[model samples]
Target: MSTLELECPGCDQVLELDAGFAGGVCRCSNCGTLMTVPVEAGQTAEVVKQRQRPARPDRPMTPGEAEAAAKADEQVYTTTSGREVRVGKTSIPTAQQKKRLMVRTATAVGFISVLAGVLALAGMGVWMLSQAQREAGERTVIEAFEYSPGANPYDQRLANVLGLPLAERVVVVVDASASSEVWLDEVNAAIGAGLTETSSASEVVLVYTNGDGLHMHPSQPRAVARWRADQLIAFQQGVSTAGEGWLDEAVARGMQWLPRQMVLVVGREPSEGELVALERAFEADAAAKLDVVAVDFDSAALDDLTGTYGGRYVPMTREQLVRWRER
Candidate 1:
């Protein structure tokens, strides 16, 4: 049978009736109003229909007469505004969870800290080793500055200044000015003596600053010394050209190689700009602890130049040349 539909007279709520109970009185589902179904003309009084519910096979059924009986059993609390709220029980964390989180965080932090500390120590060790090597190299050169055998008093002092320790790599810059011609032979001897002491050198560069420049390759210090002597002899024979000396260009050329190497300059004064550049160069190589030595005619100017680069200036004596032939 089709269902019957009707609205409540008091609340106008729509309600459905099973066709089996067409002429029935019932309460409205929404407004709870007592309502009467429209009966046939022959029927007089309204009838009430009863609904039968099936029995539950699994569990006992609760009566639906009260609204509270159909709700879940939960704790209800009344707010200050008189509204009730229901809540279920919640769980609290135990000591184990908190301790586990703390341990993991501490472990991560400690691991990172330890790694950083190890890297820092490694860097420091490398720096210390390099410094030690540089100090040893400098000491070797300074110790080799002892007085040569049978050298004159003035020549001996000059030799002390000129006899620098040759490093693994060496750059020898010679001033080829007219005024420098007289002591060129002594300069040549000092170069030879230094070279003899630096037998450990792998490469040697000789630069003569005359007109433009003269360069010699991976040569022996003794060979370059002999060559300088020959050039001096040739100069005495009036075979050399007369030109202004460019010591600045010679120093710049000497610094073209690797940093932290040895440089020996026998020359006149370099320009202030060149002196500044040389200072920066040495400063950059200071970490490597290289040596720079200069022997010049102008003692004061050489002092300033050497001071700029953390090097010392040694005064040259012409008397050194008298015993130059023995070397």
Candidate 2:
């Protein structure tokens, strides 16, 4: 048997066929055009090259011819030895080509998804590590203060505030009069709590209103001053002979310290004059807010001061001191 090759007149796509197919009608696999094969192998001439080829006619063949061709279509060829082989068409995809395309697309999408997941996991891990480091630093400070072992609620509360992103300052003023002696322990503890909360850059002032008034430590690290304050508060067996005039003077001096945001006063309620002194101090520092913890006495002046400063007046009893929780 022999074969013949020719180019279609319409599309010029090369085609091969058996000698028996001469003068037979077939479809062009590239353009689906129905054409008559050349009667002689050399009879048909190739057309000139074209950039844009025209589309095939809507009806490639008569209805009857199309039906007859479909009925006879086998899509396979057989050899004399009875071997069969499938034929190729331009528009149809082979099995191997389809598989390769699917594998490449799947591999690309899968690589992108895995890379995104790994990046997200790394970012989360870094954030968690940073948080743990910060907590560890706070815990070390809490332990150095020598408060009761484990988590002290008071220290933890203070630590939260100290960890605030904004800068903060607190001044503690305690009444050191003879009558305030009974509540000294509670006052000392409150002072210690304040010290625990003061960060390295933040400020804590311990002012004792004994005679004229005493600034125990001026602009010093809270931990160092707090220890010294404990010794001072415990030095005298009873309250000193400080009068209301001395208390007023102490408040006036505290006022001289500028840029105070929060003030804690623990002592007897102020007299009218003493109240005026405190009011003036508050006026001087417009941003200052006052919190008063009454030791043994309470008065309308304390209420008014707390109201004006947007703070609360806490009555400090032994039980109340023990039960105190940070708000």
- Give the best candidate by TM-score: 2
lDDT of 1 at 319: 64
Worst 10 residues of 2 by lDDT: 90-99
Determine which window of 10 residues in candidate 1 has minimal summed lDDT: 89-98
Task: Residues 1-327, candidate 1: write the lDDT tens digits.
Answer: 234567677666556644333344455665666655565421322233222333433655556532243233333433233344343223111111112468789999999999999999999999999999767755554454543333433334222315443444456666666666667666655555444322332345666666645544333332222234344344333323236556566656666665334454555566677666666756656532333343345546556646665544555556644555454
Superposed Cα RMSD, model 1: 21.2
Q: What's each prediction's TM-score? A: 0.41, 0.43
Q: Who wins the lDDT comparison? A: 2
In model 1, where do residues sit more than 4 Å from their true spots?
1-161, 196-198, 219-241, 287-296, 324-327
Model 1 vs. true fold: TM:
0.41
lDDT of the candidates, in the order given: 0.49, 0.53
Q: What is the lDDT of residue 31 in candidate 2?
A: 66
